[model samples]
Target: MRKKRQDFHFTGENNMIRRLVATLREYIPSNRGYPLSVDDGFDETALCARLEERARKGEEASRMVRLREEKRLGELFEPESIVKHNLLKMVCIDEGCMPPYIVQSESMGGNAGTWGSFPCVGANFIYDRMGGKIEHFGNIQYAPRHLINGKFAEGTFKLACKIDFHSIPPSTQYRVVKTPSFTPATDIARQALEETVEQYNKIYGINLLR
Candidate 1:
């Protein structure tokens, strides 16, 4: 079988450098490539590696700051009370159909509770695939402010997510899920999310969120 290109998955700073130099080469007389690099005798390849290193270091620093400041209610796959799961209580509007309060996955990403029978899949983060979290914490149609993770002067508005409970059918929640994901067209939503991911890649010049 033919081997894959070595840089096929190097969607990082080096890839950026390659694009930048390639573009410059088109306009400049440097047939080899752009002479861009750190203050050293390093070639394009070496410069690419160094740029990637600095980019990684920057990401690490930002992640550290987030970890230090972000004291959230849950960890990955683990529901922490007052964080996401239990704090997000679901009361049924359809009486005699199901219990008033919906049971959440006691363990994060394990069972994810259930809508009567069908089980939930994947990590139970602040929000599911659909903008369920937004609906979860507010009466307004959409409240995506909570999606941002950082210190904000928004004050109580940041953590306050008092939303409405849905009187949706269990069967609907089981597979179709939320109105937007079920009513209009599920395939459409998936397509939109994917298209957005593609747009993101093009904007940032990186093949991620795929």
Candidate 2:
């Protein structure tokens, strides 16, 4: 009588090898930009040789170290950062064009039980002082509510942003205040405003308000 053939089942070890191969396949890039295929099975001899070579090279990249360096000294700016930079300069516009105005006063305040709106204005005054060349000025008003712990201040003039002297360019970028003479142009305009307010009863006269 012929003996019954012994049955063989490749179970746990086979499964582990299959799983590793599947994982390697998944890790490989498949996009058109990075072509990789799974048909290249791992060669234990080649891998051992490669491991020895790599160990001898003693070179490896540390992602954490690279990240820390970037955090400390990254020169690149995010889109938001660039936008805010331009906003602070008041020169952000399409295709980098500057508005011809100077920032004068940007303040914030509000009353009880109500939020406040922001009002911004720029004027051409500084340029006129420099041989009838019209310069510009600006003012921003807003009200934001915040306080120590739980109580908000009422009707307090908080300077939201203050640019002692700001000049808007013909293009959308800010140039620093040039010359001591140019530096005081806005101050002169502000003085002129003060004079007008004193001469008249209104805080902002029609000529200066615009």
Candidate 3:
């Protein structure tokens, strides 16, 4: 039988250093790779040793290449990036509240709508502000916000959220608060919200209000 070469993996420190340097070079940006900073020679040896140690700890060369590719792709474009103004909510849903009112078209009020079903009908916060502050509160009211069946679908449904205006200590008497206000409606916010809902439906494979 022929003896196999022991030098196949790495026979000495020189081989290890060579492998590390090659791997580092392959990750250089001009090679169409990730933004790995170039070595200025001062910490090269230490960095190579650390990388070799990582490799010994099961981080393979192929995995490093894959990571560099992923980093490059992420830098180029990220999947499912939020467009900021795409979020929609009118009020904050309190965690401890029971049976929070859900907003939907009157057409979806019957037993046919699945949004009222388990998991889908649960409590959710609808913030009026981008950072989720400034919650709107009041009776569940409907405005001619959008249209569905008509030529111009300007129908809207908003839930009236109950909150205490003033609470006196040691008393259960809670004064009724006036409804909170949202900013003047705009086409951009509406469009972003609609698109976000469509995206959510596509991702979860669920049918929200048509």
Candidate 4:
């Protein structure tokens, strides 16, 4: 029997859009896609209305783009690959708060390995924070080389999993959890990563290892 398709809905007002526009206007040059004039008068109701309208339009446009891309990818990759791509994309969405240089698994050539090999099916943090100071963070994977003390060096952290292609839907065998070492910085990063993963799994009725 063909399963009925379920529509995905946004849970609430996407405040990220508002926060992003505000942040971009501060750093991005006026000539580089942002408007030059800033509205000094703040109107909460009007702003909310405009933001809702923009979100509606943006969602429509995003759906069209996704459909086109999915159709194109369908020709080049297997169904499983497409599912993995979409799953990784959800993992990458910024929810207004995330560490810098964190990237999508697909961007790091995730799911590219051969059968039985561990594919990079998780997100990656490119750098680390030390003593609550981000400026002290380094890219080296070991301590002393990147840090003054003997403690662990903050380096690339991967939160990913291995998939068993033979597993049936809703089965625990589908995902094998691959966890990164725990550190103060990684503890914070893991919270953010898990939030997105949990939200996606709950909305889709899928079992994603947390």
- Best-fitting candidate, measured by lDDT? 4
Q: Between prediction 2 and prediction 4, which has the larger TM-score?
A: 4
User: TM-score for every candidate vs. truth?
Assistant: 0.26, 0.15, 0.22, 0.28
lDDT, residue 178, model 4: 41
Clash-forming residue pairs, model 1: 73-83, 105-113, 137-161, 137-163, 138-163
Candidate 2, overall lDDT?
0.29
**CA shift at 105, candidate 3, in angstroms?**
22
Among the numbered candidates, top TM-score falls to: 4
Which lDDT tens digits does candidate 3 get at residues 1-210? 433322223325657667666676556555334433433222445666666676565446444544553454345334433322221122112211112224322222233223333122222323333322212222223322321122221212222222234754321111111112324324554444454444423432223222
TM-score of 2: 0.15
Which digits, one per residue and each the tens of the lDDT, describe model 1 over residues 1-210? 533323323444456667764564355443346542322233445545666777677568655644532333233224432223222222222211111212231231243333333343321222333322212323222335654343211111111111124544322222212122222224543453334223322332212122
**Clash number for candidate 2:** 12
Q: By summed lDDT, which 10 consecutive residues of candidate 1 come out lowest? A: 152-161
- Which regions in candidate 1 have their CA more than 4 angstroms from the true location? 1-14, 28-42, 72-131, 134-210
lDDT of 2 by residue, 1-210 (tens): 533423233323445444544465456666543433423433433444454444334223233433443443234334333222322222321111123222223222222121223222322222223122221223212222211111211111111212233456221111221112233334553343333223222211222122
RMSD in Å for model 3: 22.5
Candidate 4 matches the true fold with a TM-score of 0.28
> Compared with the true structure, what per-residue lDDT tens digits does model 4 show for residues 1-210?
433423222338676755754565466555445442234333334555676777788678666655765576566546664233433343322221111123211332254232233333333332222222222212334223445443433333233334455776321212323434435455554454344344334443224323
